[model samples]
Target: MPPIFRAPRYLGASAIAGRGALPYLACVITHARWTSQRWFASVLIAMVVLIAVATVVGAEMLSRTTEVSNRLNDRIAPARTAVAELTAAVVGQETGVRGYVLSGEQQFLDPYAQGRGDETRLVAQLRGLLEGHSDALADLDAVERRMASWRETAAEPLVRARRSDSYNVALVTQSKEAFDDVREPLAGLDSKLAALRAEGRADLNDSRRLRNTAFAGLVVALLVLIASIAVLLRVVVLRPLNELSAEVRRVAGGDFDHRVAPRGPADLAVLAADVEAMRGKLADSLAASRQQAAELHRSNADLEQFAYVASHDLQEPLRKVASFCQMLQRRYAGQLDDRAQQYIGFAVDGATRMQQLINDLLAFSRIGRMYDDREPVDLDEVVGRVEDTLALAIEETGAEIVRPKLPTVPGDATLMTQLWQNLLGNAIKFRRPDVPPRVTVTVTEDAEKYTFAVADNGIGIDAEFADKIFVIFQRLHPRDVYSGTGIGLAICKKIVEHHGGQIRLDTSYTDGARIEFSLTK
Candidate 1:
């Protein structure tokens, strides 16, 4: 099937982030010329693509921020604290050495021993903290060398000289100058750790800002997309629908002349056009139906007048001719020649047949029109009456009639009786030579109706003549041979149709003639 809505082709997988996607979508939206499906798809695809990209970017930024925060809190901060404590430990060692040299107190050596222990532990811990950091580890190595050299050459010598009572001022000055070398490296290490902490905090702040900006932009884009969809729907779907609905209402409110103009998307426009076409057809049909109803009313009036004439005027003349011919026949039976007798017989037969034709025609026309006294007509009783009416024919033909226990149906008793009578009489009349006819009436029922089949074992009708046998006056054999006006099946057709049913020949029944019909249950 052809595509109906014809949404934009760019709203596909390959076009999710295609360069032309946004431009084309924007153009259509700006021009207000898109179908609902196209606009919806375009907007939806744009939203999904942008949101996906934003989410991925935001996640990366968030991860970066978390890494930076961890470095600042765990590595950089702890390394700075260790450097500061190491600087304080070296200062304590210098102070203790100077105090011991000045006063020769043994207790002043305690701070020197404690500071040495702190320096060793701090150097190891800081080395671990700055293991992978080349610049920080270089600065930490320099600080450790300076502190260890100061402890071995300056601090240890000063403590020993003060303990031996030979600590001079020059020696104290030399120790203080050596301690300044340790301070210099410690300061450089402290400065390097401080720079690292500052850089980590800056990276963390930048990552957080970027992540927040990405999320905010995504939210804003979502709001814009939703608003755009709403606007597009209002312009492309809702307005047209409202207009179409109004037009439909106008047409339905007895304004058949109102034309439904096409609007909106291609699908909606097609729908509107179809509705308009239907309206035109309905209007034309209504006018034609009214005209035909009027003609039919006139035709029915003429038919009633014709029926009156055929019943009274035509029947009277026919009876007179038949009666006068019989009288002449009785009077001049031996006097007239055989040719004259034959001519007279022909006239009488023609008049009698003409009367039959008129009666049959009148009966056919009067069905369902003359009366409507519908009731539950027992088909079994109707068949029994028909059998009684054709009792002499049945006896002579020795026809066997097999019938099931029939059900009651809704119809006029007289019409139902005529229906069976005509069918049964035809079966009896059409018997094969020297063959006793066998007729079976069977019934099957369903939810809505009962189907009946009347099958007769006689000269079966050909499949080609199945439709022809039901037409009025359409006889297959000569009048003398079949003895019917050929209106029997036609009358049956009318009677069945009048009762809201259908009758047709069962051509598949090759062994005999079969008639199947259905009636509403």
Candidate 2:
């Protein structure tokens, strides 16, 4: 396979060995995590570049817009104003010349002199305004020449003739013709200025439109980029994560046969591969565990059946042995020696104890298959019955059993009774001589179950024997000292376990032996 297609190595030995989900998850994350980081970084950089480019384009557009505004404000508008002023000055000259030629009055001469002064000032201003405009400068020169001709050839000569009292009608006609010649050029200059102003306005409009377009494009690009990021996040991250979460839930729901397929980006795909691998290993482990448990259960069932049958069968022989031994002891009491009578007594006691041991074993084995009609058993009622049964022992030992109101729990009535009977009997039997057996049974209830503590102010069990005491036939005291088959607490353990609760010696209790157990409520 190509390098890109090759599988990633796990970070730890456990991951490579396909152990539990934790290592697999860690390995998958380590393998596939950074691809998303790089992807995000690339997108961010692209956005930055796009913003920078848009900014540059917008700046250039704004600069062009400003240049257009300056052209209209500074060049075209002022030049047009200068052209209008010059035209008015030339018109005034024509007006003055016509007046002098017609009346030859001194006031008309004053008007003529004023027109010349106005012309000089306006011409200088127009020249300055049109300094860089070659076409406007040519137009200004033509106007200047036309005005000079009218002033010198027509107005000046006619004015001189009239002053000397030699002015004629022909001179007046010539001056009028010269003044009319100036009108055409002034009209041309007006058209030129109007065209320049219109062109400046058009250029300004185009620049503004360009700037608007650039801004609109920038906005559209940013919107598109944001939308793209949202889409990418959904596709590459959210969707895959949701799918993976659902897959995990299915696995958690005990669907060991369910498989996770590789999907999404390379990293997520690798993660999926790791999860699938873990799932397969877990499925195998669960299958093996279930197989072992089934075999163990069958073996225990067979053992229990054998024990029940053997103990039931042995009881007849044990009874015969004890009866025959007692008959011998009674019938031959005087005839036999004291040693012979003691031997027979020992045999009887041995037979009786063996029978009791067999009976205890039978009871223990029956715990597995006996309780078929399980229901809610009230511990208070069960403890009351236990107290009744152990009334003789409690009275003889002067035991004070303090049992508070107890919660009702789901269990078998017979088994619950047996459990309490065994525990209370032990408390009564194992009392300290100095103190009356003060056995207190209390219950604490929580959401899931009820925890019961049977405490007694008796000789407490040693810490080393806490766990040992719950095993069948495991007794801390000798049979003569405790007078039991050593299976009472073991029976309690079995019953609690069968009901899906735990029974343990409360090692934390220092004053006495506190046996705590729980039952599903």
The per-candidate count of clashes, in order, stands at 0, 0
Worst 10 residues of 2 by lDDT: 1-10
lDDT by candidate, in order shown: 0.84, 0.81
Residues 489-512 of candidate 1: C-alpha lDDT, one tens digit per residue? 999999998888999999889878
lDDT of 1 at 487: 94
Clashing pairs in 2: none
lDDT of 2 by residue, 195-271 (tens): 87788788889989989999999899989888888998898778987898899899989898887755566677677
